[model samples]
Target: MTTPENSTAPRPIKATGRFMLAHPAHIIAQGFGSGLSPVMPGTFGTLFAWLSYVVMTTRWPEIFTPLNWLVITAAGFVVGVWTCQVTGRHLRAPDHGSMVWDEIIAFWLVLVLVTPATLSSQFAAFLVFRFFDMVKPPPISYFDRHLKGGFGVMWDDIVAAFYTLLALALWRAI
Candidate 1:
């Protein structure tokens, strides 16, 4: 995967260790290759998270409880922190755009929290999430700028999820 001489797209994180499949960190940090897309990798990664969450819930309906989702989201965050750290070091890019575990796990949280909703509702959630993730509003922007390393990478998306969830809650109340 060679970048063109003048291509602005990010080269997929130094494909040295089994092309991002050999190591667990690389696989996760790359969002199972969803992050490898040259265009809107964050969007692709979040979509992957949405699809994955839907499939999981559909396949195992009993597993969609709030407690289960919280546990799963927490575990993903813990693992994401370590993997993001490793992958960032391996790529030598502190916050590579292609490293999208932040989007994947963060969006997973959104989908899980908003379960049992209509497709339109889900779409609205997705759009709101993408907007906050992309624009990085207020505290989100502050964390994205002020934090460092893997924590910084994941913090902004978590904040985005908060904003998205807040919006969805208000919409639900109306």
Candidate 2:
């Protein structure tokens, strides 16, 4: 039996192995594509945080003062919710990996106490903050799990920052 001209079989979709650029959540959630890295996207995202901190601490040290840090941390918590909700809706995905703004803000929160005037101290603080963030022990883990949306995305890192601050304080005291 001959098939009709309009009755051709549908072709199977072949995987193109191409990376996607325009996500529903806009560029922010994709960490400006930093989150799309093949490995350790979080680290890459944190680098952005480090650079931002360096700039802020250098150019606007007064804004990063102890009192300002508290204000910034609180602001981060509030804004994080809006950021997360926006990205979540954009990507149609809950807490997409590309949403690294939260990570940046959270790391900055941790560095508030230990932020050093010297480059070496800044580097040290960055490393320490990264370590604690990665480990996510105790309360950090609790926050990570219990919170939802942007708060959930950012909470663990915030707690990690607190832990790092405590450790740094104790270390300095010794």
Candidate 3:
């Protein structure tokens, strides 16, 4: 017997590069397309940020100073807003899953706090940063849900980075 005309399921919405690029905000906020991964997009975005950290630290250690961290964080805040606006408009939804630029910036911030000149130390920092980000304790969760727009997206991760920094500092002290 032939299936009914409506029996076939509707095709899934395919995420397209053109769709992402329709807005300029998405381009910068998504860390230059690192946030566009189909699977585990946040993780992939964070990895991209980590790789950037590695390069920055190795090639331009002088530029990785505290002042530079502040600058980067500020830039992330500005860019994050645009990212949220773009992704929200494109998806017609707030804080879409595919928009992981905030995570990338947050991971990068965390890296600055715990960064060691050694490869092992960097790996340790990465693991610790991921843990805090995923766990989202206290204020981090609060900010994540309550805040709106790009600020909301970036703030939670910043809190997570602070938490990771504190934990790592304590661990090192002990």
Q: Return the TM-score for each candidate structure.
A: 0.86, 0.71, 0.81
Number of clashes recorded per candidate: 0, 3, 0
Winner on lDDT (1 vs 2): 1
* Tens-place lDDT digits, model 3, residues 1-174: 446565564433345578667777767665667767877667777888889878886789888876797788778778787777667656655666667778777777777766464667767767777777778888888887898876787778878778877887898899
lDDT score at residue 73, model 1, on the 0-100 scale: 84
Would you list the C-alpha lDDT of every candidate in the order shown? 0.84, 0.67, 0.74
Per-residue lDDT over 40-65 for candidate 2, one digit per residue giving the tens place of the 0 to 100 score = 76777778777777787779987777
Model 3 has an lDDT value of: 0.74
Q: How far is each candidate from the true structure, as Cα RMSD in Å? A: 5.2, 8.8, 5.8
* Structure candidate 1, residue pairs in collision: none
Show pairs that collide, candidate 2: 24-90, 25-90, 29-98
* Worst 10 contiguous positions by lDDT, candidate 1: 9-18
Candidate scoring better on lDDT of 2 and 3: 3
Root mean square deviation (Cα) for candidate 1: 5.2
Model 1 C-alpha lDDT per residue in residues 60-79, reported as the tens digit of each score? 87976657977888888888
Best-to-worst lDDT order = 1, 3, 2
Whose TM-score is greatest here? 1
